[model samples]
Target: MNEGKLPEWLHCNKCNAFINSLSNDSRLYILECTHIVCKKCAFARQRQSGNVLCPVCGTTCAAKCIGGDELPHDVQLFMDQSMVLSELDRLRYCVQVTLLAQLR
Candidate 1:
């Protein structure tokens, strides 16, 4: 599908936020009727309604998450921080073990 520039007012119907078509960090799910929605909003709607339906067109469409590699910047940053904390915990454990051995 052609990734054309989304109109300025083309916001997610659920969240009412701009779809951020300019950023690779924002994921969007396009409905069969050409309506676009953000990933989070789409998932929430699917959970609430038990089916994915286009809010604008009232058409049932498959809600597939797009932009897997383009997750929101804040989310990506949080994942990075979590990984760093996990590594630090592992290193601290190793250091404690070494110090205990020396004391013994």
Candidate 2:
């Protein structure tokens, strides 16, 4: 996981959902454990403060809302906002990949 390189976005093993990569904006703030999740699943388990749990892996996280613990200034931020993916898109994308390999 080199910083500034493409983020390693992963699908959650538990719910079969794509996890989002953390963004610099998010890293600069106090949001914990950058992970992507489906909006529907995230909404269902949203915390009172509006934080969300990882839809796939069950990692607890805050929604777009920010506030929790801050990272140190010297630490280079590795998270990026660009890597988040919707559930349907993720599923569809995976299917396309599978289908393509089958054709080959």
Candidate 3:
């Protein structure tokens, strides 16, 4: 972990706001499509459009707000990574099951 600093690329996929530049209490959400979004843009999109969709992939598949804005940037980064890995695992399992079924 960078401790006092986060990578430059660590940002909301939509607004491109650097995580470190965000306020200490800035909310973030992890989209099911595995995109990270800041709460401002997310909620604004929701209010304007009636739902928060991934701007990058335009997926309303799902989104998760793991916790409030009080969480530290490092913690938020960890959660984002964990969510992505979990999604990948689920997808891999689905592909495996599909391939096995097709062989039968």
lDDT of 1: 0.58
Better of 1 and 3 by lDDT: 3
Model 2 regions more than 4 Å off: 1-31, 65-104
Clashing pairs in 2: 19-36, 20-36, 22-79, 22-80, 23-79, 23-80, 23-81
What lDDT score is found at residue 64 in candidate 3?
61
lDDT of 2 by residue, 1-104 (tens): 33323234443333544434335432212225554333444466777766766655566776542211343221223334433335457889999999999999
Score residue 25 of candidate 1 by CA lDDT.
52
Q: What lDDT score goes with residue 83 in model 2?
A: 31
Per-model TM-score, in order, reads 0.37, 0.30, 0.46
- Compose the digit string of candidate 1's lDDT tens values, residues 1-104: 12333444456766687764545456666665666678666655463555676766677777643334443332222233556688789999999999999999
Poorest lDDT segment (10 consecutive residues) of candidate 3: 65-74
Ranking by TM-score: 3, 1, 2
Off by over 4 Å in 3: 1-9, 21-25, 47-51, 66-104
Largest TM-score belongs to which candidate? 3
